[model samples]
Structure formats: structure tokens, C-alpha cells
Target: MYVQIDLDGPAGTLRVSGHGLPVVELVRAPGSPPDAHTPIGSRRRALLTLRVDGVPASIGPARGRLLRRSYRVDARVGGVRYRLMPCGYEHSALSRDGRRIGTLQSSGDGRVVDEWEGAPDPLDLVLGTALAAAFGTGAAPWWETVGDIVGELIP
Candidate 1:
């Protein structure tokens, strides 16, 4: 599985490769204090749009859905890992502190997988997340809508 995580937008996109992947470990940050858990899930916030190999868009993924799961990871990397729940993200494959992570995309039924190259910047996590969201939508980010758009992409 592949995943990318942003601290500010608090958003990300991941593409998984197979079924029964160990996704639970991605949530929360690696080695985070147990008191800080994945924010209670919000369906409105978790709405993910998907496209298969450039197929038409779908609100719910065709193969599977990405779920957010909270977990603790190598503290040297970040201390905690708040990963997608049931599905996986690029963050899982990368060191928590690494910048060149990928995204993990899953189908609703958890069948297929796709991991796209990610572009996260070490300076601004929000900007990096917005960039990723734009990539997912195949649309350019409007200069004015950047903050709100970025905020909407993540929780």
C-alpha cells in the first residue's frame, strides 16, 4: 500500500495494491501519545471522489473505499500515524517523517489498488495537500479557493 499524509490540511490520498492490507497501523501518527486518537470519523468529511484509470468519476470508489484508522508508528519518523481506516495510504509505506510519500487509492469493495506519486513539501503541509487534491480531481486549484479547497479536502 502507498499513502501520503499532510499535517496541516490534515488530508491525504493513498492507493492500495491488494486486499486484506494492514491498514489499521496507518491511523494516528506513529508512536503518538494514545490520548490523541484519530478524530471521530465524519462521513461528510470523508467523502472521497474516485476515478478508475481515467474512468468517469464516482462519489464512492468502484473497487473499495478508503477508511481512516488511528495508530502509532516509529517515533523517529513522527511519533504517531493517523492513517486511513480500512484502506491504506502512501504514508504506510514511507517513513513518517519522509517527504516523498505516495497516495493509496482503494475501491469500495477493497479489490483493486493504485498508488500515485505524491508531492508533499516539507515547509507547508497544507499546500502539499492542496496540490494532491488538485491532482485527484484533474482540475487546477483556483488561486482564491486554495485555502477553503485545501480545508475541504481534509478534515
Candidate 2:
């Protein structure tokens, strides 16, 4: 089963729905900086919180390794450590214990594809989408920045 996330919803909100899953709403907390304005090829670090159906879900701080492009966010939902990270360009992978359980497409209307054996739990769907919406796709390949710099130097 795959959860479809609509990022084009009303400002500060995302809508998640899929097979056998109730329509879940994720709302960005007020005062959080929007991730859309981040420049390409730069690391994204947005301190944001999303409310699941009006209840605040505690999402841990996003972490990144020095000199690495991968960005990660860790959340303990019901005591299970869940991690969300970029597995590819514009794609966010959801994993537990180093195993990818799902993926969220960050472009356009996002979609969370489930790799779990059965229908995805509602909480996981919400968490994955929340993390993706918060930090996904603000950066591009490092070479893009270098290319831009070279273009400027030549001109």
C-alpha cells in the first residue's frame, strides 16, 4: 500500500491518504521557517514540528554528517526509533534499524510508497510524510553549486 501525500494543500498543511488508511492531516507548527525557499546545493536544516490530527508529534532534530550529503531525522514513535533520510534526489527513505521500510517522493504531490509487508500503520505514514515535508529536497547535487560558480567566473 502506498500513502498519497498532497503537499499543495492549504498553506502549512499536508494531506495523507491511501488504501485502508484514514485521511490524515499534518499541519506545520506556526513560526517554522518554510523549507521551499532554501537554495539548491546547500544543506537543509529546518526546525519544524508537525501536528498529526491536531496532536503535536515530537520529531527529533535533523542531523547530517560532515562532508556528507545525506540528511537524517530521527523520531521515537511509541518507543520505536524511526529514521527519515534522503535516499536519492527528491526522495526520502523511512527506515527502522537501517532497513528501508518506505519512501516518500518530495516533488510535486508527495507519495509515500510502503515497503512493509502489509498496509502501513497510520502513525508511520504520518511520521514519514511529516519528516519529508520538513526537510526533503531543499538541496541538490554539490556539483550544481560548483557549476554555478564556474559560470560566474567565466562571465
Q: Best candidate per lDDT, number?
A: 2
Clashes of each: 48, 0
Error of 1 at 78 (Å): 7.9
Alpha-carbon lDDT, every model: 0.27, 0.55
Top TM-score prediction, candidate number: 2
Return the TM-score for candidate 2, rounded to 2 decimals. Answer: 0.59
Model 1, residue 118: distance off in Å is 13
Candidate 1 lDDT, tens digit per residue, 1-155?
23333222133233322232222111222233322112211122224333222332222111212222222111221232212212223232222234434443222222223343554333123222222222221112234346666789996
Model 2: per-residue Cα lDDT over 1-155, one tens digit each: 56566664325556666777655554555555445432111122243444555555555544453312446677665456788766566666678656678876554345434344355567777667656654453344557656767899995
lDDT for 48 in candidate 1 is 35
Candidate 2 least-lDDT 10 residues: 37-46
